[model samples]
Target: MDVTQVLRMKGGDGDYSYFNNSLLPRKVISMTKPIIEDALTNLYCDMNFPKTLIMADLGCSSGPNTLFVASELVKSIDKIRLELGNYDEPPEIQMYLNDLPNNDFNTIFHLVPNFQEKLKKQTTPNSSSPRCYISGVPGSFYSRLFLRKSIHFVYSSYSLMWLSQVPEMISTNKGNIYMSRTSPPSVIKAYQEQFQRDFTTFLKCRADEIVRGGRMVLTILGRQSDDPCSKECCYVWDLLATSLNDMVVEGLIEEEKVDSFNIPQYTPSPKEVSTEVEKEGSFMIDCVEVSKVNWDASTDHNVILFEEEVQGYNMGKCMRAVAEPLVLSHFGESVIEEVFERYTNNIKISMSKEKTELVNVTVSMTRNR
Candidate 1:
């Protein structure tokens, strides 16, 4: 599916009522705070030199969560300022909030004014007005976006797996993954290729965009290990497929429509990601860890907690948040509600706080000077 169609299909006014707003930037920021903070601290000597450094949050979703990263960033930089007693030369940060063009900029941009207000109350001793500038840039992260050697700290959460285009192999007869029970070797290869392509370019672009000592902290869905062929591969792809399958069998959707669709493989093993980074040869990996994301607090009594937890964002984000339009293309709006119900039930059955976890990994690396 193209970007515009995707935005509309997954639009708040559209048929995707189950996408769940939880996937918005707010959750991501909450989810990724610790990692981002640690990286910023390490990069800027605990953010002491914020005015001199450049920090950018790329592919940031639209919502309050988007502010989470910037807030952590400014605070970290401020902490650094206090320690150095150079409160006068506070950090100058350029915050870039990115997303698909259809992402609600009104909501994302609103974060800036809120941030300015928050900073006003907590101004440091040496602080003059912070050189903190936030601008909304809409585009695919896979292509060129940043200035060469300009970024000091680059952070992205749950956003790198998308490629500029769908894998070509999926559209061909040789495509084994879309037709097979599990991800076929060909499909896996195709996705692996796409990831490598996207990742290498990402590193290269960052290498160009970041200064010599610049660092980046990126967290993306990753496999528990390097094995990509496993059935319990990636939650986004496999579970989403399973969800769609339920809809197909129930006659709510067409089988042919799904036969060719492919989920951009979001889950990669640490080794797989490292291999790609190594290919770029510009960044040195500092950390790669897979941790559980506690997104679902729902137990038997989901009553208010589930709704409260979900109410912050649109429900359309729940069922098809990651790939709503693609799934919709196969199932259509007629089966929207049922798809989300099945999607939720299947997840409840398959996932739990104790056993199954939202598998993701964080990679922190500094650019080669």
Candidate 2:
């Protein structure tokens, strides 16, 4: 399947919806809150505050965290306004919640009234709060989504690791859905080149949308090691490929199908990200951090009792939420349960040995004036 057709979180508020199972991403959002706050505060101090503070959360899938971010940002801006005492009145806020066109926006919109009400209650009885307007901008973030020089701050969490589309014109790496150690040098190069192109495009587009001195805080799944084939970065896909190969051996799925399926994802190193930003020439990197999160951090169940089952089940569900749609799009939906069952077993065994983790890279950039 092509990148556009395959890339989306499992939709709806159902069992597999990102809303129901995106705990990892939700946690990442919380972890990055301090950075977001600091970036906003810095933006205000660096320039004359505007009447309407334009901001956007790119790749904001449908979930509670969507409105929660909006609420927190509005509050932070208000606090900064009061502390700085630069404006006569609190600035109004225009927040754009962005995501793919296929995202379940209804699920998010249903909660908007409550979000607005909460914001309203936070203000004093007589005093007015800053007017907050929330809207969804449905599209890919790799391209332009706003007017030139419009947005002041942009934030994306647990996104940007997703390539706009899978790399084109080569498929030597067989039986793997992503870049793996077994993948040839050509395949690795292809993936890296695609990332460079997509990320450069992303920075260029955001540069146009953001006003001079605007700031963006982005948190993405990344790799600490320079090699893309490192265990922390590519082991998940390796396990997935192993499961698919098992299916191939059992005649449940065709080997050719497995060979052709390439996941449109990339976990970049810190250097890779910084290089793109510098090459794009639109933004200067304010800060870049690479942190690690344990693979089982989101698993709250009793691991001692149902160690394998709990770990495997939780891991499967988490991955399914993010990749089920793509898997369904590529292979029929019928194979999803069986494939994940095998994947669960593999993860259960893998987790028993060494603790796996994900490296999260958060980059804060300011638009060059």
lDDT (10s digit) by residue, model 1, range 158-235: 777556556667444222323234545676677678778878887877788888877898888666755665544554
lDDT of 2 by residue, 1-369 (tens): 666666778777876667777666767777887888889999987867767889999988887878878888898887787777754677889999999888888988999999989988888444567888989998889889999999999999888999988787365678778888788888999999999999999998999999999999999899999999888899988998999999999999999899888888899999999999998899989899888877675575543354655766677777888878887888898999998888878887887888788899999999999
Q: By summed lDDT, which 10 consecutive residues of candidate 2 come out lowest?
A: 300-309
lDDT value for candidate 1?
A: 0.63
**Candidate 1 error regions (>4 Å):** 3-20, 23-34, 46-50, 124-131, 170-181, 295-317, 351-354
Flag regions of model 2 displaced more than 4 Å: 85-88, 124-128, 300-308
**Cα distance off (Å), candidate 1, residue 183:** 3.2
lDDT of each: 0.63, 0.85
Alpha carbon deviation, residue 112, candidate 2 (Å): 0.8
lDDT of 2: 0.85
